[model samples]
Target: MPPFGQGVSVTLEHLFDPGAVAVVGASDTEGKVGYEAMANAVAFDGPVSPVNPSGSGTLFGEQFVGSVTDVDDDVDLALCCVPGPAVPEVVAACGEAGIGAAVVYASGFAEAGPDGEALQAETAAAAREGDVTLLGPNTSGFVVPARDLLCSFASGVADIPAGNTAVVAQSGGLAHVLAFLSRRQDRGVSAMVGLGNRATVGFAETVRYFDADDRTDAIVLHVEGTDDGRALLSACRESETPVVAYKVGQSDVGDFAASHTGALTGDHALYAAGFAQYGVPTVEASDRLLDAAAALGDSPDPDGPNVGVVTAQAGPGIIIADRIQRAGGRLPELADETRERVDDALRGVTYTGNPVDTGRPMPEFGDVVTAVAEDDNVDIVLVYELFEAALGFPVDALSGLAGRVDKPVLFATEGIEEDMAADRRALSAAGVPLFATPERAAEAAGVLARYAGLSDRREAPADD
Candidate 1:
């Protein structure tokens, strides 16, 4: 395998927030990839110029240049929308033009056969010789929701709104999937990047960069595989910000993963173990990864593994308890005083223990939750309640309690989607994360407790 970025300066800032962007092979044709790249690049919060070796024409209000070097203004990033065989020259020309970075949207590199591998190595050499950072050879590109910057050619990705979470994935497709899922959850992302083919930049570099980024509160890493595990471990260990990882390639798909990203999917068990040792939580599914990162990012670090479950209905509450406990979370018995308070609030009509079941929505549902949230043994509170038009969400009560308490409180509910919109917004404004299902809420609560346990383990002194 050929080395990458020997002399190149890899500045993620240039890749993420470039001062100017050039879309090489830009086209005015609506259906062309070049056209889509141009359309998205124009939305960037900087000067966006189109570069085409063909005849120049006006598209998206920007005049096309014959070459990147021909452009009068300096370009910090170039979207190489050209073919694989054409990438090396593009990188060299971009370097000669003083462009700091370039994103290769072309495929058929290392992921392809031997000839493609040679092409990838050549592309890497050109990038290194040019001292330019490269993002991908098979990437769908990235999006910065806050800046309204769309560095990708993929559709629907441009609509992702800005939020506190940053998603970095090995697959551009998966990255966009998580972004859209976040949007569906009414929670968006700060930035979403795909490390496709990883011609130069990989997870370690991206993680370290996002760790120092103030815009990112939490990072969700989607790893298919990697050869440089130690670098990733160090980066995750150094991050004070919360990180949740989703590792794929669990089945007998190592060869497929290798063909996909040019990196062999190493032992999945080793990856999980190393991630745990480095204090980073790992999840298997994409939704779980997003939920964990969202909960950890928005909610306070939980103090312990004890979760207080307060449900308006018994069935969903039972489901939440099962999921949380299975994920290593504890539903501790409520303090006697706490149970008494819950009983008084619920009129002894339902179970008032750790997994407190309110039976149904009632006037004092908020008080029942408050008692559990304030319990001495409850370090995290998980509440599951179906929306009732008459009683509605306990927004005011939970918001007030969350404001005063230092623990994590998660709310899960199912209701008429349109009707719950306003309350959902209100809860979001209060810094409370609301899930659409009992299992999701419980999974998020379990993530909180797992993170807290990791912290405790890290802080504990070594055995004598």
Candidate 2:
């Protein structure tokens, strides 16, 4: 938007891992937005500086300064929790203090009306003049679990565990929701950013930023609308980071999106096509978007859609196979050696043709998974099970098998109970994408297979 690097040279690292952060307009009052922001910032890894016009007291033993200029510290990030009208002034102060970034967590900007639009532009100008990056003029902020920087005012920001998946969303609420859901599933996030208003930094820049982030393994994007789909697609295409996008406004809600953040809801078909062309998968649901990203994070993309499944129970395996086909994936015939090895390992009557049915969870289940993983025809492996104390979830065996193989091996199970907590933790720690349902499993595999196919096409020698 500002010709790449014309201003705001500070990157997302400044926002996520700042040396010191100042909460502008901070309040000691409970249940207030500014207060909430300050409450969260107290957990930041670096020094948390509170800045208020009064600047007369302290919160959590940290003294409040009258203003950013008065802090006398190098503030890498500033959370501007003041009103939208005062954002320009707060930004000017932050610039004067040499702050690199600010999260203007206020609404009533361009999304409000013409007057608000003018205000949003003025705020951006203030940020640019100071060479500071702005997260939102009407947005939520960002959360980095690894750095313990909860710049966001979101409630669920506290308990998020650190992991490799990075989330980027247009809606602050949805960003937090994704982060919460991911954490709940044991697939914690590296960072969750809300590109509110996109006043200065937007999706493409953020995508590129996370692409370079060493902590991030996979990236998930939630897009409401965008002006330049091509640019976004190009950045994603050039990036080695596997991206999963969940773009809303596909069904005649352009007006609402435009009013929401002055965004242009680009044609959904073009977005779909662009993503597909660039080896990116688009999920239809928000939760599924995170699911896919989590799946891709640990599971390397399949070179083809030929999936081999191992089910502790027959029904779930069949369901997985059906869903995989419905999602435009394939189930190729297992190799003779593969089927024979799995058949020999079976201790009971089970189907060992394609989706190797184990009849029930057994210790030999790991061997079955290994047999499938070694198959030359099989590009992906899906393992399904019903968690039971008798079977013990096979954590050690599966964990060991996953490491032995080069291909992607995903685990899916039904049932959730406290008793299974240890097993879940063990598998997750070993870097397995465990889905709660067969549908989710298939959806994740679809992303894996689809992206794999696209990558294969891209690597193929072009027709001269």
1-464: candidate 1 lDDT, tens digit per residue: 33432322467887887888899989988878899988888988788899997846688999889999998877899999998899999999999999989999898998888998999999988888888889998889888999878989988777898999999999988989999999988889989999998878988789878888888989999999887776677677777788889999888798888788888898989998988887788887988888888788888788899999998889998899899998879999889999888877867657877688878998888888888888879999888888898877898898857657888889999999888888888888888888878988888888888888888444544332
> Per-candidate TM vs. native?
0.95, 0.95
Clashes of each: 0, 0
Q: Please, what is the whole-model Cα lDDT of each candidate in the order they appear?
A: 0.86, 0.83
The alpha-carbon deviation from the true structure for residue 352 of candidate 1, after best TM-score superposition, in angstroms, is: 1.1
Q: What ranges in model 2 sit over 4 Å off?
A: 1-10, 456-464
Q: After superposition, how far is residue 78 of candidate 1 from its true place, in Å?
A: 1.0
Where does candidate 2 clash, by residue pair?
Answer: none
- In candidate 1, residue 170 scores what lDDT? 94
Task: Please write out the lDDT profile of model 2 over residues 292-332, one tens digit for every residue.
Answer: 88878787656788788888888888889999988767888
Question: Which candidate has the top score in lDDT?
Answer: 1
